[model samples]
Target: MPKPNKLLIVLAFFSIYVIWGSTYVLNKTAVAELPPFMLAAIRFLTAGVLIFIIAAVTGQNLKISRKQLINTGIAGFLFLAFGNGIVVWALKFVDSGFAALEISAQPLVILLLMWLIQGKKIKPMSLIGVFLGIIGIYLLVNQRQVLNQDDSYIGIIMIFFCMISWAYGSIFVGKADMPSNYFVNTGYQMITGGCMLVLLSLIFNEEWSSPLVWSPNVQLSMILLIIFGSIVAFTSFNYLLKMVSPEKVATNTYVNPIIALFLGWYFLDETVTLQSIIAAVILLSGVYFINTSKRKVMLNRFGLQQIQNKLRKNKVQ
Candidate 1:
């Protein structure tokens, strides 16, 4: 791969750190006015189509084998259609910052999932992370504000399931048959996931509002979500994985929640509670512990490609 300029590298880091964090608020603002599934469907479909066009222009082959297509489809369903789509639905009830904070425990969830599903051993630090993660989640979800709100509990619970789906998808895609090129692979998943989201929207009978009738804020939010959230951030994430060390790329996991919390509070007037602040610290610390513990074992057991894929398992969202 050609070397990216320093400016470009900085911009890529900014995209994954800042723009990715901002996605929660962007989606929250849009989902307030638009059907969640439909909104996701449109965002992904347009992004997917644009990816294919870009691929073609760049002379990248868009073709894949039958098995690869099937695997990508399954990934699409898990990671995007259900994983991200449900989170968008849940955002209607929960604060964007709160959702981002809860999801930041992703490394913890992945660790437990590996232990339970693959029979992998959990090291001592990860075990500590697990304990902290559980406590943090208890504090986060047990809030009076969260429980008092209508359906917020359900939304919070559903977001946990989404985290699981995303984690599993990450593992599966790392080992599964996938396109060699990350761009092509993501495009295929986006298209497949977008189709599934459309199907889900139809099945759920979500009202399909026309873009023409959307409020200006919603229209801008959708544009931002599709362009910056889906495309630009993803491209930056992929680029940085090649240019930087895993630790640097992984810093986004920590920074995203902070950015989201601040943006949500500043933009949408979302409340940041004391308990939630404590939970955020605990949850993010758990993530750090989990990632720190797993680094040596992962490097020894898995090849570089697998490491990259596992790290890339996280979405631009």
Candidate 2:
């Protein structure tokens, strides 16, 4: 009912844009040495437990109804278990930057899903944005030659599905009967998702090397992924969803790929061809259009409302 704090909103945006952007590279690094599902399971479980502890210490209620748990569990399965677990697995074969670029398509997917499920009409400009996004994806994928690499293509497909799963989860959580405490809800999601990942790992017979054998770099990456990526950035994202329009909250798609590309290049020495740069431009431009179009529509509606209010006052007078 109250106005959202501009400062907090900006901070939350930064958290998702910068912190989550960095996570692509961190995830790539961790998955290089760790089993994908197991790594995700551990990272999320640890982050969830720590968040729960923090919530308890801060005097937040941990209670949840069975329905809330079920909803959050479904969200957790979609978001973390499928969305993130697949991304982690894909990072083993795909470049983090390339993966980030693909994942940027999430906004478009979310928009389409919202329109289909909620019967929200897509604006003309938003439709144009979606077209541009599809073109951009075509260009990016063509540049990558993903089909040539058997393993890499599978990874690419997995990331594509990841985007869909994440988009659906993002929209679902908005309507789901979850806890009012964002932290509490996020912790439950993480825990549920992590458990699912662990179950998947067991089903697939994923072998986990002893943590004692992990390289220092892998260890550090895992720590950062758990603390900053899952705990801090994810919580910021969920908080922003509560504070702002989902479209606005999703603008991180525009910023995250840039960060991921730069980090992947600088830290991992990943190649970024000129074609990739062009594709990035095209893709990000589409995302920009999609986000701004909605804002324009909202502003137009507000302006029209003001004009009608003025005319009504004059007639009444």
Candidate 3:
């Protein structure tokens, strides 16, 4: 196989790591001023439209079978509508940094779900990682300050659900039929998910009466979310998935929380207590263990065969 492009990999990493991390802060800011469902709906709808236009202009095939459309729609609803939308709503009660940290436990949750729902065998190290993750979560949630507030616990619970929804959606996407063009597939997902958010907003009667309600900060955040957060970062991630090993691409999960914590503290003046710092370390360490263990399993199972197949394919090409 040919060597990968170092520069493109770096750019893709930057997009997914930095851009996605910063989005937590942006989402927090926007949801503070705008209704969460409405804000998410508009951001995704605008991004979806922009991406769809780009796909069309670039002559990418937009066609999909009915099965592909259904699967894509389901994945979109699970990922965006429940995963992201709930996190945005929960941000009203949670700090952006804390939310990011909590979401970083997604891999562990996914592992557990696969084990329980799919009957996948869990490696010993991965089981340990799961236990550690639970401890970290307990540490974070049981802090004296959090314990004193009912709403904080509510937000934390909501974020937990968000992680589960996101992980399930991610796992589903791997098995489900989708358009061959990643950009077109992403566009459809965004459009379908955005429509779901809009429907929820309407059902809930979210306040959208006046333009004056949206502050300049909220407007700017929304625009950034649509462009950088949704379109650029997501496209970069898709590119990376094709060009690099999934293990390398998964490093973004490690980097993003750190970036989110720093940005939240620097810009938002969010609290970063000693307990929170310790919790972050434990949570991230657990995630590290989980990922490394899973990588080992994957390599043991398919690494050699896949490499041989790839080499043969390259020769044919």
By TM-score, the best candidate is 2
Arranged by lDDT, best first: 2, 1, 3
Q: Give the per-residue lDDT of model 1 (tens digit) for 74-141.
A: 98898789999999999988999999988887777777777888898899988888899899989999
Best by lDDT: 2
**lDDT tens digits by residue: candidate 3, 87-186:** 9999898889888888878778888887887898888887787888888888887787666655888899999998888777766765667776767877
Show the colliding residue pairs in model 2: none
The backbone clash count of each candidate, in order, is 0, 0, 0
Model 2 TM-score is 0.95
lDDT of every model, 2 decimals: 0.85, 0.89, 0.82
> By TM-score, highest first, what's the ranking?
2, 3, 1
Q: Please provide, for model 2 over 143-198, each residue's C-alpha lDDT reduced to its tens digit, 9 standing for 90 to 100.
A: 64555655887888889999989888888877777888789988999999999999
Off by over 4 Å in 3: 1-10, 209-213, 238-251, 301-317
* Model 2 poorest ten-residue lDDT run: 142-151
